[model samples]
Target: MSAYSASPSTPRTTSRTPTPPRTTVVNVEEFEMDGRSIETKSADHVPIVFKANPFKHTYPILRHTCFGVQGKQTCEVRDTTTNPMFRDMEEDDPQIQYVAKPFRSKSVQKPYRLRCGVMNYAWGKQSTDSAVAQWMQEGDPTYQVEQRPYAELWVGTHTNAPSYMQESTGSSSNLVSENSSFANQSLHEFLQRNPATLGDAHTEQFGTDLPYLLKILSVATALSIQAHPEKSHAERLHASDPDHYPDPNHKPEAVVALSNYKAMCSFRPLPEIAHHLQTIDELRALVHEDMVERFVTVVGSDGSSVEAKKEALKSIYMELLLCDSARVQQSIDAMTARLRNSTDLSWVESTFLDLTVQYPGDGGCFQVFFLNLIELKPGEGLFLAANEPHAYIHGDAVEIMARSDNVVRAGLTPKFKDHKVMGEMLSYDTQPLHIFRPNNEGPLTSYCPPPEYPDFKLLRVSLTEEWPGVSYELGKSSGCLLVTQGSATLLYCGKDCTIPTARLEVSVGSAYFLPSRLSVYFSRMTDFVAFIGECQIRAG
Candidate 1:
């Protein structure tokens, strides 16, 4: 039987008619980059349906290139002209890396989105009030840019910049930051005064230290093996090299697998790495005998020379990172050929080959075999703590971490490659492979797990049949809930609100903050994943 029944008879004793389901109404205000309020009249300049996803096969067709095609206009050019903000964006801009899509690989098994921050660029380009009119009514009337994107896809939120909407897009809520200070008022305005659950409150509380972080990852290739710095290393580096390093904040993160996830975790035992490093027949000829001997000496039988081995590896990494790409590729190719033929190749050897193919010239390709290989089934996850090193291989995962955007790159990237700095800042201490797991310790234990970073916690909420009817409470922590699968209704304010699974319906991008006092219920087709995290503020 349905949960809410129809009442044929009127409300007799109370003399009050049952309240009909109320329509969801979101109030989005306009603002400039400098944080000034603008009138809704300016919305014509920045139409709600500003731009759609640039990918071709995806719904709400995306514009990839800088040029506008026959029917579709290129968002790059449109963004440049319409929202002149891109000119100010530099590589060092906190928002750039803050919202960067770090997934890049050649063996991606499924479709993934890229450049979630691109939406922010769209928003920065023009106020919705001004751009909307130009894209829509200025054209052939009906042929305006009015199609909304999917909520699952990247749009706008505090984590990342909101993509300007050309049309009414997602099945979920639309996210917009009216003023610079993202507060409960904005949450109230976005969700239309609905009371949030405790989980919602927890996710909504991302404070001022680090306000937002979001990404839409597509794994076209397998990623290299790597991990991020803990708060200590990050702080030290930030203090040491203020110009080049990351902000000194904890980086505890969560990844919601958008597709099948494949990655490499920490290094295998020293014996394992040494054993594999020795068995390579072809590699023996490619590398110098002296270098090979050094590796053997460092990897003794007892594994007693741990510090020596680490130092040797540090030296080798420096040499390789400093060496020309051609030289490195030659060694990689030789190893690949040898591993391809040998059945006895060690796990590390095989991993090297896999990453080499995924990232041809990346130095990270060489480091793959030293780490643990983790293959995440759809909806499965692997978390990493501070100092725990890990690199994403292939597939799109919704990543939620602390507000700080400090990343010291080691390898497997075209953007930034700083081995010296990374080496100094990285935690070489060995640890277990399973970083993300259920917290057996805590007061608010409801499948919501706190990340390695004390500042943040990530909860993976998938509505299963077991949760046929689950009511998620909003804890004291403000939080954001990003739906990754299926459609569901959020029961709030004494009524049920339907949240569609379609991308266009959930255009609010990666964040949906719920306050502490409110609670919400979910009822939908099973198998929906949400990346819930604490927001930066608290409502007194």
Candidate 2:
């Protein structure tokens, strides 16, 4: 895989010229739709295409089958009176199986199934069993592969390269490390081998891996309330208990809405949390005055509720955890019962009861009272640096963050639900979390939010009409353009361009490599959009 190269204001020249226009253009052939020939205009536009598409893509549409298996459910690690954490909501829960496995089969039978020059399954594209079998054909070498699958298309390597199917090709393809592809591979090992398709200089400077990782998320269901530790604190905890703190670093993430997004971020200020806490008659039974006093002290006039809530939480948690199963269950039952009957605050009754039914015997049911609830429209995004507690409630989005998988959990999960561990790993000093909005409105925002990752940035291009015009200069970072609708054209060095198929182009999705520093792009379409992200590029 090639890393990004420096911009070449003047690219190396190739010698290919187009023929002069004729008085009357001849129709090459009637356009085919529904297996029939449809007439076209005199000047037909050729969409962009790719040869040996390089975008490392997958369409593993994950579905929730979380109700079944309790044995395989993530067991609770907390010493609480009652284990309130649930296994169904955890992402890594073993029994929680994903419905569709996108990376298993290799046959490229269908083109559109692979969105963005890469492979991705968002909304259901696999209906018939026959179609599923046919689409799996891309993995089959026997099927014919073509050059220029779509018009104005791009495909190549970037800093974050995908792991290729090993033992089969001996050489890896340009793609990222997907769970399906590298189920047995360590995330660190995969990064070591692929080394973000970056330039040699960057490889020398920043080492192989980039500081950040990006993800495309489709939330079929709500995520559990959670947060991550700060950097230094995380390192120390991992040293003390390697089994509990898997990685040595902290996790800070940002999510941009690709579809409608919903979440509960930081808890309301102490006054609000205290306000909400007061209305709950079960408060005295669940916590102590010392904890209440500590919370009141921190909820000081500053208006930052996160610090006080987190501090007071550590104390309240230690108290509840002192008892065994029976006592804990009694406390949990009382709180839940209060939520069901209290008409004073509908939010407490409704949200709490909904969680009780959804998670049954889990303690994280209490987290709903302590977070900032929000609904994100398409194109909007949320940024959570280290120690900021957050969770996705519903909807799907594109996620980007520093390239580390280290995470610390507090409640809302059965696996390792250790608040002491989480509290110790966090940065107690709190600040307001920021959200980003698009410069324009509508689906374009859904397509692209303001760039979140400092290492990699993203932009959106619309092709709903003819091709929308966008001016960009490929400086040092190599980049890719992903086509999501109609078709487009890539004018390479001004000539030698080809038309690619819409479905075929799907495999290339949102990633492409820029080799010669810079190239200009133009488009033609019916209704389409493209997401452009910076590739791992550097001065040669």
lDDT of 2 by residue, 1-540 (tens): 211111112222222221221111123222221111111211233211111211122111112221111111111122112223322233464432222211111211111111112222322122221122222233333543332111111122222233222221212222221234434343335446754334354556445554444455444334555666666777886788778766666566667675677777775555666665566655445567667666666665466456555667556545543434465456568877765576675654566666666566665566566667778886677777677667675555656555555566665455566666555544433345577776452223322222432444555555444224322334444344444334444332211212110111222132333322333343433454555545333334
Q: Give one digit per residue, the lDDT tens place, for model 1 in 1-540.
A: 011211112222111111122211123233111111111111112111122223222111111121111111112111222334334333453322111111122321110111123332211112223222222232224543333321223322343344221222222343221222323233323333332323343345532222335444445445434455666777877898767555776666656565666777666666666665676553444356677678777767466466777776656545545666777777777767767898886655666776776577666776665566777765555656665557776555666655555666677766566676656544544555554443222111122234324454455555544343333444454455555555554443211211111111221123344434333445444444455554433344
Q: Pick the candidate with the highest lDDT.
A: 1
lDDT of 2: 0.43
Shift in Å, residue 394, candidate 1: 1.2
| CA error at residue 51 for candidate 1, angstroms | 48
lDDT of 2 at 238: 79
Worst 10 residues of 2 by lDDT: 67-76
For model 1 the local lDDT of residue 498 reads 18
Candidate 2, RMSD to the unseen true structure: 21.1
TM-score per candidate, in order?
A: 0.56, 0.56
